[model samples]
Target: MPITARQLLQIFPNAGPVAGVFVPALNEAMARFKIEGRLRVASFLAQVGHESGQLRTVVENLNYSAEGLVKTWPNRFSRVSAAAVARKPEQIANIVYASRMGNGPAVTGDGWKYRGRGLIQVTGWVNYQACGSALGLDLLTKPELLEQPGYAALSAAWYWSKHGLNELSDAGHFLDIGSIINTGKTGTAPHGAAERKALYDRALQVLE
Candidate 1:
């Protein structure tokens, strides 16, 4: 009843231009993360499908400059800083300052760098570094590499293995995953609760 590689391929036939390559990598990561249960796998895949638009929009607005960089502070302001860091390095010349999202007037410092990536959409430099360390990758240097299917998949797996999907008890609470990935806000207003429940139901049907 579990979603097999074939079914996943069918579900996301057009998973970006590199579906052929990415799918295998995704499957491998899924297995490595032990995300085999039908419902759990479906839930995780569903989240990825929603976030990355089936891996088509990896760098959120096509901004892949800092694809693998981890954001220590992921506020809206930080997102502005991250954008600045990715663009005008001179503006925030110091790597330490730049890495910290800079104290520049242009940088928002509100924390938006924690957007989406991998299966769980791991966000923030701290998380990126943590995930990278877990997976043996240098996220600090090539944070944008998270856009790459191989690295993205591995990051997601690492997050799941560490956090455990059980933390996401309610299938309807997609924000839980979002929080895990984004680490921005808590579950104030539920978004994907019902839809997630429906998705879980569908997954259960397949399992049955």
Candidate 2:
């Protein structure tokens, strides 16, 4: 059966003020991308719900005015070893100042550039531009709009279309969505692919 707007709201009851904004957009995106079937809908919603905290954390720290990706400071290897890190007072102050000033995530070779945003957690400037182009929106110019529900929906649909979601069997690689959203890695992970697949299967069964 096809997923409906009511189902989404039921799945995420406490969506708050953004419920009005997200529901219609989600319906539109699902339809636009021809994402039919209850399983796919449930999986997509589950991933987005987990990522955005049911739409409350859409713009990170409620900083819709935030221009671009703002990630934590890098460690000695210049890698984002941890998602949330304890920062020194000066570092915390600098991050705040830079974010307000629209400095965005520093374009280093480091992997920190890909934080999270949009419905699918669109990351990196290249991805932002690609998704924006796919949806006929200039994300590079107005990157902050990814935080907006409407734009976020469009970007996610674009990603789903581009990533060939319709081609893969939902049950075969259910963790693909989670990997895509969380780590920006697609398909399966090298070390824990089997474990991830098991978890995905369990979640899908419960959702269904």
Candidate 3:
């Protein structure tokens, strides 16, 4: 069943009017990606809800404080380096995301250009290229397109399906889903895991 705006709002009460705006797009994306059925839809919505901040934050916020940078990517930034780039979204992104995830050096600007965006936080050059190709959009040139309602939901669904999350949902591997979404790896404890599970449990009740 296509999820109703009411159901979405129930899952994300703070979503405000954007909840209705994304309903049709979400429904279409879920249908296209075969993210139907109660289990799949519930799981998909829970993750997307958490990732997007209830359909409000479609773009990744790179503005981090010095401590935040050190904590989030402890391996990447030292106190001195993080303090210099604190609150500098672009600079922080270029430096932290540089030379990884198919990004070029920070000087090349690929990291800032392809910073995480959309519902699923699609980051890096390769992901933009892949999601664009799958959705028939030139995301390399127009990476901000994912911030739009339709593309945000669609790209998120594409990522979910690509990672075989639908099957995981079917098997009730909800924790694995959170781990993959949060840490990009399975079996490890994910950040905000308790919150993700709470969202999932609430979503199941709503969808049921």
Candidate 4:
């Protein structure tokens, strides 16, 4: 069954103006990804809820404190280096995202340009290019388009489909789905794992 805007609002409550974009995308993605069951919808909603903060924003926030940098991106910043760039959103984005995930050096500006956006925080240049191509959007040149509500939801659905999350959802593997969305690098203790799971539980009640 296709989800209604009323149902989405029941769960999210604050989806606000994005409700128009979100509801249609949810139904379309669910069908395209073959997410037929209520469990599947619940699982997808849970992860997207956590990733997009209930559809509040599509862009990832790069405003980090020194401590946040150390905790969030230890591989990119040390205590001294993090303190130097603390609270600098753009600079921090350029530095932490530099030279990885198919991005060039800081001067290339691909880091900040291809920074996380969309409902599921799609990062990396290669991913943007691929997702854009799949969705018929020129995301490489206009990365900000992913921040728009329609593309934000569609891009997330595309990512979810690409990762075969529908099968995981069918199997009721909520944590596994979360791990995949978290970049396939965390365990039960992954950041926001608990919150994601909590959202899943809540979504089950609302969706079911």
Candidate 5:
């Protein structure tokens, strides 16, 4: 069941500029990642839609206000700490992402260098290295490549396939899938689980 550019646009109307690129990338990725089943296709497209905001943004938004920081990363940005780094995406990325996700300490610049990118927001040095190796892109040297339309779709599909999301989709364990995709209280009812599920159903309507 190969998806067409027209069908893709039916679901994602704003994918105008990159439709020529995205449709082919997605079709290629489907074959590479074995996204064979209907559920897998719907789930994959739905998650990518939610994460990338209907294919509008490939990079993560790091510009956080003090209040946003406190709400988003309370542990990292206490009231006092949030104020200091408010509206500073680079500084916030350095502080909050420091020494984690295979990143170096705050002073090493690994945080900003490997900030979240691609359709699924691949974060950290380890992720870049692995996804890069899988895609043969040398992302460690040119992390910005993830922002490209083809690479963004490929990287996200790689991540989805690597994580065995197809199995989850087959088993109808969407909540478990959400847990893996995001950090939320429950695997099934995470922060954006409802929206993800809704989109999944919508995509299924089109894909089926």
Candidate 6:
């Protein structure tokens, strides 16, 4: 079932005009990915809502404080190291994300170039390549295109569909869905697990 702007707002009241703007794109993406059933739709919307910050921030914010850097990636950032790179979004991106997720070495700048974007944060070169291929977009050349509402919504729905979230949703194993997407410890909460669950509950109620 296609969600009305009113229903979306009910789930994400802080979205303001973004709810209406995303309705078409969201519906299109969901339909394309077969994100049907109340459970599936609610799970998709809830997770997307949290990740995108109520449809407001589609791009990943890499700005980190020294303490934040240490907390977010303890293995990568000692106090001294964190302080050195603190508040440097590009440098932080290059350092923490370096040599992983299909990114080149820190000096290569691929990490900063491919920092997370889109509603679901289609992160890294490998993911961008796959998602771009699926969506027929030239994301390698224009990575920022994921910030656009259409691609943002579509990419998120595509991720949800591809990752088997629909089955998790059907089972109402919402936290597992988050952990899987975050690719974090299974059965344990993912980052922002509480917020994700809260959003899921709100979406379930609103979608009903």
Clashing pairs in 3: none
In the range 1-208, model 6's lDDT, one tens digit per residue, is 9999999999999999989999998999999999998999999988898898999999899999999999989999999999998999999999988999898999999898899998899888899999999999999899999989999999998888888889889998999989987874467778888988998888888877
Candidate 4's displacement at residue 39, Å, is 1.4
Segments in model 4 whose C-alpha atoms lie over 4 Å from true places: 185-188
- For model 2, give the 10-residue run with minimal summed lDDT: 62-71
lDDT per residue (tens digit) for residues 54-82 in model 3: 88898889989999999988999999989
* Model 4 pairs whose backbones collide: none
Please write out the lDDT profile of model 4 over residues 150-199, one tens digit for every residue: 78878888898899888888887778888888866435454588888888
Best by TM-score: 3
Candidate 1, residue 180: Cα displacement in angstroms equals 4.6
Q: CA lDDT, every prediction?
A: 0.57, 0.58, 0.92, 0.84, 0.86, 0.91
Give stretches of model 2 more than 4 Å off. 1-5, 61-115, 169-171, 186-208
Between prediction 2 and prediction 6, the one with superior TM-score is 6
TM value for model 4: 0.92
- Clash counts per candidate, in order, are 29, 0, 0, 0, 1, 0
Ordered list by TM-score, greatest first: 3, 6, 5, 4, 2, 1
TM-score attained by model 6: 0.96
Over 1-208, each residue of candidate 1 has an lDDT whose tens digit, in order, gives 2345455545555563566666677777878777766556766766565566665766544223443223432432255556665643333233333344322232543123433456456655677778878888887666677878888877876776687663463354555765554444556533554554454455455545
* Candidate 5 residue runs with Cα over 4 Å from true position: 14-16, 184-188
Cand. 1 Cα-lDDT: 0.57
Q: Which candidate is the best by lDDT?
A: 3
Give the least accurate 10-residue stretch of model 1, judged by summed lDDT. 102-111
- lDDT (0-100) at residue 176 of candidate 2? 70
lDDT of 2 by residue, 1-208 (tens): 3444555556666676676678778878878887667566655666566666666775444222112223332322122422232333223333433332233543332123233567776765567668878888777667778878888877777777787765553564566766664555776543344543443344355447
Backbone clash pairs in model 3 (N, Cα, C under 3 Å; residues 3+ apart or in different chains), count: 0
